[model samples]
Target: MSPQPQAAVGAPLSRVDGRLKVTGQAHYAADHAPEGVVHAVIVDSGVGRGRITGIDTRAALAQPGVLTVISHLNAPKLPYLDNPGGYFNPQGQKLRAFQDDQVHFRGQPVAVVVATTLEVAQHAANLVKVDYDTQQGSTDMTDAPSFELMNYARGDAEAALSSAPVHSDRSYTAARTHHNAMELHAAVAQWNGNQLTIWDKTQWVLGAVAELATVFGITPESVRVLSPFVGGAFGNSLRVWPHTVIAALAAKMTNRPVKLVLTRKQLYTNVGYRPRYEHRVRLGSDRRGRLTAMAHELKAETSRYETYAEAILDLGQMLYATPNVSQSYQSVALDVNTPTPMRGPGYSSAAYAVESALDELAHELGIDPIELRLRNEPQEDPAHNLPFSTRRLRDALRTGAREFGWHRRNPKPRSTRDGDWLIGTGMAVGCYPTHRQPAQARVRLDADGTALVQSATSDMGPGTYTSMTQVAADALGLTMRQVTFQLGDSAMPPAPPQGGSITMASVGSAVQAGCDTLRQQAIKLAVDDERSPLYGADPDKVVVRAGRLSVQGDPGRGETYRRLLTRNKRTNLEVLGGWSPPSGADRFSMYAYSAIFAEVAVDARLGLVRVRRMLGVYDTGRIISPKLADSQALGGMVGGIGMALLEHGEFDNRDGRLVNANLADYLVPVNADIPEIRAIYIDGEDREADPLGVKGLGEVVLVGVAPAIANAVFHATGRRVRDLPITAEALL
Candidate 1:
């Protein structure tokens, strides 16, 4: 049997790094101040699709403190390496910043102005001018030309749909959304001989190292990436974008350390975004609400150079017990930058469509939404025909419903009213596929009883540092103050990207393994030494607690690890622990599930929708830190509210440019927009999943929220809004 997870694994503790974060001692990429480091500002193209016709940098060079204005006209052509695995780039566009005059999208970096000061660089960048030969570009997913459709089919969906007793066909649209993290993307590049040292804001340091090495024609080992602290990522920093490469190129060209910070405007155009999606779903069910057939067709926008596809229909095939299921996903190539995965990516879009359709069907059949969902629950994954590793979705739904007082909800639209507001409640199921990756961690125990754990994974404001420290402390039998967790450096033990909610499961296991090894080593030393009280005791009978080794059933006979190390004349003991997924673990159904309930009050006269309360019950295997997990779940729900009622990236189809590029125009949920939120985790385990028994809670928490709120809005006003950002205009 696996050993128990000690200390804070299930404890409701605050973030271990909370003090450092609040005190402003955490070091972010832009916070570093290296000696002789210059500043750089990118000059972006104004035209959406164009080729440069002229360049004039005389005025930019004439400015004081200006070093050089580098553009495609003078920049050297570098090697464009082949695509490496795991970095999701559909375009396969090799790192080619400032390599050509051709522009594929608006705000594409045209040139970079370097100067002694950030102010000088900014001023010089505006002084540079360029002429463009513009061409009409399409940004609208509906208007853009599409390619061959990708299809998945199980049985005869058309026949089943036509023969079913009840059927519903609906269309839904999800608008483009930006990451909009609090910290803007920045990169600091320095070259010592042929080796490159970069302090960059990124989700995957190994991916960044490979990308930079390939771009500069250098070995991967020659590049060092550091991002010890990140304000927030939300999948924006998952890849090293062109801006990072441009900074490195600029630094190498001028032979000086350079810092480049992307402006908020540049963030929308350069970094990846959640692509807009249009889905048409047809559902067929019997009078008993058993799903008979499901057909889903999806179209989304991608860059002209890339064919990006979001698995918007993957869940429909497995979520219910539908025998006839057919899905087709297609993409329209547009003159825009390639889109990447956002939080919940395809699953969020899928949930919005499928859950909203279910709500509609429930209303049509005069059936309770929860009852309808329960009637169609599958014992196994219908698509894969495999038993689940561990599925507690029914428990989650029941618990959430009871907590939300769902039995008292009035199903009839506009039937429940309070004063001038129409009140209603709704719920939806959330699911995210569980993913695992191999990871490594190192633990060093010093003679003074202090321990340090190191990994390449990053925190990104999710309390990764704190959680790992807790895991290390518990495994090593040390206090929290005795352990320090270090991450966000490529030099540390390698780890997978911190996104996908896999960091804690992968890295925490490694920390556990490392600490266990350290403890066992100390035990072996204590039992073998003739001078120790446990000299004759069997190593297996010795247990370490509070950094002290003692024989089993004898608490009084123990020696401190510090004393043991001092007697051995050793300064410290170090161990490296590696963790990979259990063999054959992927052969079964694996996913994290959540049931979300929302209460809403819609102003009938003003056509305004306001959320009043939200409750989320999750079946994430084990709670690592109850307080941190609660925060993650609540934060995800807030983000979902924004996706449902406020957030949308408006694009000007005439030029394919994002119209609301800045914060003032683009909307996100503020503190005033959030409602009272609560989170509950089903106390459970999936021992086969991992040593930590943890499934990701981050992405799944937000998956069902938008649809739940949308369903509630319909219940409040008798309005079925299929599109996202269900605004007052939609109600009106």
Candidate 2:
């Protein structure tokens, strides 16, 4: 077994790549300038749903510096093969780029103009005229045709609601939101014979390799995707999108290295966004706020050609102690790009409804909000009848409350006023299901006492590079600077996709295992060697610290790794470690939880709300790096503020077109909008969750944030808004 980490894992360390980034030495996807590189600009479909009638590319081809124009009308046929299993979509055909005349969604790539320069390509793309047979399509989640993909029931929820002493029926709607990552979606494709190398912006390099291989009818090994750095992903980069396919296709047709970049408008549709959601929650509780039942009817938007589902209703069934619980999850077809997972996915949308509804019930019963929640806290997962790996929800609540001065909050709405502002405090529970996946890593130790660890994972702004390095440094008994961590390459060790907060728990475990293997190898060699100072020492009693092997309590009698390896004629020591989550029906329900408290000031006459202070206490498993975890927590809260007050992806119902496709129109919280914020984590680990004993943290941080703000707004105004982005229009 590997010894506990001491020097690095738990320490507050800066990112190893921070200097490279600050010095402008980091190369992103678009920064790669391949030899003989050309540019390809995509022509997007203007209609929401249509059939391509005719495409005119002659004008584009005649433009100066225009290399070629490829469209469905003149493009070569691709394999357009179906994925073996769930490489991309488990069900239904994926969107094939420039492979057919049918336009399935708005902003779908219609044509590509390759040119010697980006300006020429842009001008050529504008010149390529496309005619479409427009069709009326559905984009509304509430009224679209729905298919029930999931249904569950434990008892009679309707009867419980009918007989309960207090009941609240409410509906909450969240507008569609886009993942506005700082780095634009881009791909630089280069091919030598059959070997393809791509520098792309993506969350999963292997996923991109697989999808690109399937599209070109090539082996996965022939495609290599590299993404060493990502500005941000949220969740939009989890899968390969159509523009990457177009870049490859254009590169092949033009017989040159091609760089393709999506415009800001194109990103809204080329990649996926958080689907619009309509969640109807009905809750029944006794007069004391103890639960009776809950029924969650969820409707979410998906492309007409694909099915997208999430855990929107799961929290309703398990978040509270309810005897009778039922859930129905429905997918509504829309004439839009396939919906992708955003920051919190379904959990964020569901918590907004469930937690806010609970607040409404509290107001109806004239009970304290926190007291009402405590009255129904479950001893175990009520829906699954299983013990939890670890649940520190009550402690998180109390800690957050005490720190935020919740006990001093004036319970009466509008009672605490600061001149023109009405002060209120509110809190809600946040959670994300604990997730783990199979992963592998390679650790190599050089004779120079430095270590290198590689895994095919992503950082995506959650400080993955920094966190993984910390784990490897401690596991290998080296200082932070002595170890280098590398990731975001398909050729590296296989890892699970970098979404759902799985990288730290999965890849981190694989890294720890790899380092442990290397450490054990060194220890065995040192003890077995006659020249070693600690010869014939008990392998178990020998500990390697700072690359020096010493017997416990006898550091004086030890040998340096440099001496051992030099005497042993070894240049490098390398080991591979793999981590596959245990197989079996889970007997313990696993999740990370948080109790977030917020204080908001609402302008009395103007109806504008501003967050005064926010604090979150988390039941997350042992935090890997306090600094990175703080960044994650703070970023999540900021995103939640956007979801609650400013962000909304409006659509024109008549044309099924996104109204606020650009960032200028879509408002996000600026520095002025955010006030004092803080985070706390309960100290401990979930041994059952993974080898690293960490439950996922990134997603859970965003859950329930919108509802917490909305609930606080209610406390200030004594009015409830069922929809998201509690705007001044709704508040007034």
Candidate 3:
């Protein structure tokens, strides 16, 4: 069957909330100020590990405007229920804020000061004194005391690797990375008796609501979380952090609403970050570049309290299709806040190691990198033994090559020199598995000729509002201006957390269901009403278009929805839309694919590497918004550039300190660092993934990007660096 007439989907539609954002009307978490709201400032533990021996808050309480101070000594211990389902919670108790005197990591919140103003709160917090008995804690991943290997196997990988005629073994490491969003980690909490309401910057509001309710020993319904606008999350706000709890506790203790905002320095410690990864790979291939055996080991850092994990072994198992494959994964506990998912998470880091190895193998075999990949492309998912719903990676590679003029380049390293710079071209394959979760939405069409859609989801700077509006507009045959899409309120219909690249597939399917159901209701009414012009028309053939219900073959014989609803004495027609995972989903392997191409210029004399241009060709299924898709592609590339050459966090294991915690010290890409970027998407659909035919696109755009740039750098200079931020010193 043909799809619906798409007037909004696939169109270059601008964001519906663009005006609200640019005009400063958008209110983020810190922007909310309720009646009698106070401020809360938190104090950090100076010691890495130990027990607080003493506390002195007399000076802080004596200061003017200081409301009160909270510490483990004076704070009430109602409940600290276990958070077993947190994205990265490990066995044993999760860290409880203000529950005890024991400190688990440096920068742990030891005390909080509340005051009438932010300045007074900060000053009072500084005046408060705390003394602790210090103990040394292990903060280095390489010096971990214990290890437990995870599960992954195929045919005997060790035997295959030893028997193979051509093979290479290499190691790689990625530095820890912080998610420095435009907005700081903040929360505003207000409690009216037992009911708790909070405005916090978070990626998962429902998770926050659940955690807060469990901690306070209240019903889930008693807690409400609001995060209407988020500057940027990148998975940092996916979990319920310690600071959020501090804000709520301060508010409840003082019997007034309280706001808490993390300083730039504090943002590095409490909020989660992308863990540093240590990767080792041993791969073998035939003369034609077909993979024979693949074995890899991955180790990443986590906090002593929580064990974090992501999809890191996916590529080694199935990416290139080998007869024998083995993967060992382990998490090294350290004295830091628990790590969380950051853009692309494990796949992006794994790609840097695997793609770079593939490029090296291709160079050794004198085969074009693209040609080598084509030789090993799998007919089905090698790991799951399932047919792909859609895999257009070949098409993306061909198109990207054609568009980027790949044929004009020389493959030999340092061969294409232009005086001060040696230029080269490189490409890598990208993959990110598709994910879906149950979602619900409520749609209402009023007699006033307008529609309202509500869901408990978040945007997080992804243009979710505009894209969702487009989905509803097309499904219900309504113009963009006539529809209002609302999100980020717990009062709305239930929705999955808006991360893991699942929002569009999960929430969008629900939106389509709601819109289509509401439209069908209108059609049934129009076809059955004796007073309507379309009476006696078959309901099966009736269609809604431009607010009018008409017979499929004859559009002229129809009545406007406004007239129908008014004549029936009904104010609105409402329906609840829901989506469940398809039963057949398990029969197919679903993933979004991309072919990233990059050109680089390296100065041999000064050891400087610069990206000249970049192109990302994606096989993400069924784009609902072209303009938004293009923006995502560009943004992903920019982030990849930073990952390849600039972004890295320094830590002092001796003191359990993140050395470059502030933006001024930490490096990220600026406008002057990026070059021209182009994004092209293969037009296609994946019906098996969802009703909307969308595979997750957010994570796929970032995968393979760092590797593509690194390969280009290797081609420009004969050096191969196994660590991240491919430094100038390494190039030299």
Candidate 4:
């Protein structure tokens, strides 16, 4: 059959659920309240590492409206079955709440207080006291022992670095940061015999269902998870935290529905956060700015009980062309919570070190930064030994340079000034691999000329609801108003976990396939009907528009789907379709690309750095929704600014406690701090990547932002600060 008309695919449309969200009608996880609901408050350990000795719950039990105060000493022992679907922890076991008396880290949940009222729960939680036998522990990654996580080598990098004409070596450090989204993590769980239902703040409903079932030693089919709306997650909500399991356990023990919400301060300890990292980059280049050899050594913090690692060495191996390259990544186990993927994951951290080192190399060779990057563009992926599906770094660089007026930049640092402010401009390139997994979606078209598409995926503020609707409308030959998309329920068709920028490629493709199948089924029925206007027409030449089936280039020969279905006594048409990526090695290396540019002004006397303007040019393939893409790009740039000059997770190593645990002490960019920002997309699509031709967009937008701002800071001031959140003291 002929391709569906591309009417709504690239349209700049508003969010479909905008009215509900603006009017406060949309309910988040914390907003849910099941019947007979009771409140639960978790009491955490004060010591970093120790064993519980004694508990005093008499005062808490005497309080009015208090249901019970249960700790490891009084709580029933759970099965604690092995969870194969749990979050990625390659080395150690995940944390199990109330399973034992051993305390692994500070802020570990020790006991819980359940009460008829939330106020009573809070007061009773403080009344219950626990004593522990404290032991010394290390929380600082710089002082902890390191274990080798991964290593890679292509050639003799040491020999090549020794003989190179010019060399650059530098060390860069990034402070740990938290997601701190507007919504707090919450869960409301209810149990009926063996069946369990939970409303929780999570990125993956099916993953949570699987995890909860394993922890309680129940069948997966007995669990149902629902999370219809999420304020924002970034990456913290991808896993099932200990508190979620605690809520379920509490409901089972109390025989009443339980509601648990993490306070703002509790968020710092309960959920996962990005870990602090230290990187050493060594580069060897020729006088002409071509790279000869490169080596990277990295160390990051992780919980002593669970190992956490990311693709921190990917950029060093693939971003540039080098004959010899070597990399080693290590995790320094600390007395802290396990780190999780935040925002851009590994690429964002890697960019700061790799791009900053490249800028230094550009200065040493007396070559333009963009020009030097252009000189070493690899013809193929050196690590994968395959051609790129669509590598548009060159196009992104040239487009950003022209739009940002790169010709006006002065090569000398601190050469341009406006009154007391020193002005400078810098640019960097970023890349993220395209990831796709198995996904299935269901589509049903009613005789009333409306459609409903559903999947088990989620929308964590990336406009998944709007984008999927667009794809479905186009595929089904219907208008935007005639289609509705539903998500964030485990009862729907199975879908991959929503993270890693894979939702669009995997879930979207499934929607497209299902809609296309149902539309064609309607057309086939019409063409076969003897009484229809489209009777005897070739099915290959049929096209649909506004619920009407017509022959190609013949508007008069058509029939409305409502009339055809009503006449045939059909209620509705339905189909279930899925999309799966091929197994084995891919034929081509696929990745999204970005070229980011930033301009900053620095006050020499006060040591204040202000971003004046920013621009990001992206080649992330087809634009499903232009307006939402801009929102993602601009938000990422703002986050990058925080990484460069505002955000930091300070730790008091004496007890492995986060000093700035609250938002009041922790800093983020506000309206007064952000400047004019813009996003541009290069025109193209990558058919080799996915059926939708979209290489994921969310993660790549944030990958190179920090390095771009950091490089601009170096140009504005003569001094180079290797650490993140460039402070006034460092500048002075």
Candidate 5:
């Protein structure tokens, strides 16, 4: 076994690209200013659901520098691509901007106005007129049609509820939320004869290439997609949205390179969002505070063209040891755009409801919330009946409680007050299962002793570039400056989507494999060369340190890699490393756990709630880069604060249009909103989980935070607010 180096792996090192980012040199997708680029502005339908009766582009075409206006009337037909197994949805009316006359929702692209300048394109887009045959559309989930329940069950929930000594039931609602990444979505498309190149803001560049290939009826090899820097992407960039396709089509139609950047209003209608959700939870507990039964019912909004469902009850069955658990989830189809996965996705929504309900149960039974959680910790995953790779929920809870001074918390609500504010502290446990995916990478060793690694994963602001480089550096016995990590090009080795908190576990393993292979080759060369000092050393007994090969017992009698390569007249060496999980590994239980603590202050008069401090203790195994891991932990906590008090996407129920489409109307946490946040990782490793023994940490940090804040509110005001964004209005 290789000994873990304490210096590089766990040390707090700043981002390797910090200089590039601060100097305005980091090139994002939109920063690629290609030559001969023309501006394209999409004209959207004003009506929610309608058919185009007439389009008058005569006035728009007469303007100077106005090249063409492509509408459904003049747009060419495209192949209606098939979506396999819900992985990618390419059909379903296909947003064919300038290809179809029917409008399913408001802000549906109807025409493209091409001009020499962006202002001309904007002016021409307004000049193009269209008449619509409008019809009524449903936008409100409360009023939309409901379907039969989708059910999951283990034991008899009703019977267990009937026999329980105590029970409580409550309903909670979460408003829709937009991703609201700082950089808006933009696409630059250029077409040459039979090939197309696109620079777009997307999480999955390969998925975008495949979608564009099918839409254009061309080979996948003919398309190249590049996105190096992303301002932020909760989950909005996971898939290729309609606007990207529209821009590619517009470029082909005009025979000119086209650039399309969505306005803030356009972002609301075009990009993906978290759908509104309503949950009803019923909990039954014994007098001693052990949960006996749980039943959850959930309903969320989806688009009429696509059915979307968030597994909001997934946590209830797995997080606890309840035997009688039952859940039903359904979606109501409305005339709205499809919703995609957001940060924490199903888990966050489920945690808010389940954790809040548990708090209520604790209050009813006169039990501390932490004590109640500790009482129900399970040895195995109850839902899957498989043993966990590693579970530290109890340890996390205990450590967090001690560090948070949880024992000092008053059991009675409104009992602790500080002058004009009600001060309270609360805690909750967070869990996110590990998702495994196969990945590949290429490692190259130059004659100068420097190394280069290539993969197809995007950084998306989690320091994927720096962390992967660090792993390669340690594996290859080289310093950080000697290794260069390359990614964000589809032409590189394939990889899984960067979401799901699985990037490090998947991509880092590939990097390690590649560097390990390169090191082994260097060792073999040293052992085989007659001129080398380590010529007679056993290859198996050899190890690399500081770019040198030597026998395990003698570090002084070693040959440098550069000297060996120069003696052999070798310019460079290369290898490809691939990793896929072994069979039956998926059958076993797996997950990462976290304990979160939050301190909050509530105004007794105005009903205002403010978080004063936060702490998260995580059990993510084998953090590759300590500084980057801490940043991820703190950033996730801030996002949770936004989910709890600021972020909400509002839509006009009358016309099925997003009402709060712009940032000014929609709310998100600013720098002033975040409090003093801190994080601690329980140092450990799970060799059974992966080669690197790392479970993902990106998504789980946001899971339990909202519930902790809501529980703190209950501790402060003696009020149980079930809804999200627990505003002053709700408390009053």
Candidate 6:
């Protein structure tokens, strides 16, 4: 079959929903207001761990407009049925709100106050007091007991390390960090008997439906979720949280629509955060800096009830061509909410340890960092024993080095300085495994010459709406203005959870398939119709351009979709296109790779570190939307800057309560802190990975970012800080 004409797919188009977002017309979860909707405010426990003793609701009930204060003592028993859970949910019993007296974490919701207005609900929630039997809890992972979750060994790493000529053994710590998306976690639930409708801020609407249905002991089809827009998530809204359950339960109890929006403080604990990690990496290399053996040990924080794990060990096993590699990953049980994937997730956490260790080894061997990485580049994935789908990491490193002027940088730390500032440059390779899940998109071509494409995917600041539309427009041979892409509704065709950087490869492929089907249907219709201009033309040789189906190389022998569909007496043509990871996909190691370079300036007297600039060259296949990809890469660089110099989730060890929960306390890179950031996408495609020839991009951009910045800091100060957020105290 002839391919559809390429028009919109590679264009650097602006987001189709940009106007809606900038005009405040895009309705997020909290913006939704069902008629007669009541407000609910969750009253969370102040103690880290304990059992509820008594609840007092006299003052709260007496307050005007206060409807009800529900707690474990007075709340109805929910079925709390078992759920298999989403991709990100840990394998354990989930926290059931208002149905238990046991408080496992400091911010566990103990009660909820419902009122006519949000302000009234807040007031009542504060007034309704609860007493707890507080017990000391282990919030610190350093002293907490941990159990091994994963252990892998390809060869005798210890023996090889002992025999190697050079070794660098180092421990690294990454502090807890919050997503802190601009939009707070919010849910609005309206229940008509057993049928439930919820407007919630979530990356996966169907995931929320399943969880809510299981919690209420109802069928999954009875729950409907609508989340058209998200301010930003960074993996924060990927799971169904307690507040969503609270909203639905409150609405059921009150027989009115209930809206629950978490405050900024509540967001810090109620939603998931990046778990604190402690990683120790021991590397052994030859005189030429070729890795001989590597050993990795990592322990991350997780709630006592659940075992949350990520891809922390994969990087150690397959990232390079080490002859011997052994890895152990453990999760430390703590009195805190279960952690979830943040931007880059486990890959970013591991990159800091592995890449920083590589940098250390390079320094010890007097070899350039880029040269060391090239020396250790693997011909095949040593862990899986598979060839790479498309490995261009070396090209990315070379391109990035050339673009960033790496040749001019001094090798010696603290060698380049300007007045009171020390200057340094560093680079690190980034990689994230390419992921694709089964996804389906529905496409409809109306007789009016317009198309509507929809999937259950989400746009949590990644421009899903625009990118999918681009795929649809080109596949259907329609102009961008004639095609619309809709998402974030559970009622649409099913799609996998919109995390893991797979949406484009999965959902966009589905969209393209659906549009291609519709376009082919139009061509068949025209060819079969004797009255149509393209009568008796070969369907295989027909191609579409701007809604007109024409014979290949003969533009004049065609008719518009409007003319053909109207003649056929059909109102619209519809098709459901679907895609799944092809069989034998595991035969190849698929990953998106990048080379991130950072330049930093360290103040001599003040010990302040400021990033001067950053450049990221990526080998992520087939840029779907260049503008959005650049935005994603640049944003990732800024986030990496924060991870290196500013962001830290300060937990009070006494109670596991996050002290710096608010934005005022938690330091993110502001505009002033962000310097010029540029992103480059290599010209290539990964046909072995997907039909679209595209590998995932979102997570890859952030994978090696923190390490690049951390390595740069070491170059600037001549001091290697093992801990993240290399603070001023360490520099001083």
lDDT of 6 by residue, 197-265 (tens): 999999999988888888888999999999999889999888899899989989999999999999999
Model 5 weakest 10-residue run by lDDT: 85-94
lDDT of each: 0.87, 0.87, 0.88, 0.91, 0.84, 0.91
Off by over 4 Å in 1: 1-5, 82-87, 583-585
- How do the predictions measure up, each by TM-score? 0.98, 0.98, 0.98, 0.99, 0.97, 0.99
- Ten-residue segment with the worst summed lDDT in candidate 3? 83-92
Cα error, candidate 1, residue 384 (Å) = 1.0
Pairs that collide, model 2 = none
Which ten-residue region of model 6 has the weakest summed lDDT? 81-90
lDDT of 4 by residue, 1-732 (tens): 677788889999999988899999999998999889999999988999989998899999999999998788878888775434333533577888898988888999999999999999999999988999999878887778898888999989999899999998899999999999999999999999999999999999998988888888899999999999988999899888989998998999999999999999988889899889999999999999999999889999888878888887887788889989989998899888888988888999999889999999998899999999999999999998999999999999999999999999998998989998988888888988898999999999999989999999999999998999999999988899999999999999999878889999999999998998898899899989998999899988898998888899997999888888998999999999899988888899898989999999999898899999999999999999999999999999999999889899987889878889998889988889899999999999998988899999999999889888888888889778899988878888
- In candidate 4, the residue pairs with backbone N, CA or C atoms under 3 Å apart (3 or more residues apart, or in different chains) clash, namely none
Q: Give the higher-TM-score candidate: 2 or 5.
A: 2
Q: Which stretches of candidate 3 lie over 4 Å from their true place?
A: 1-4, 85-91
Give candidate 5's TM-score: 0.97
**Residue 198 alpha-carbon offset, candidate 4, angstroms:** 0.4
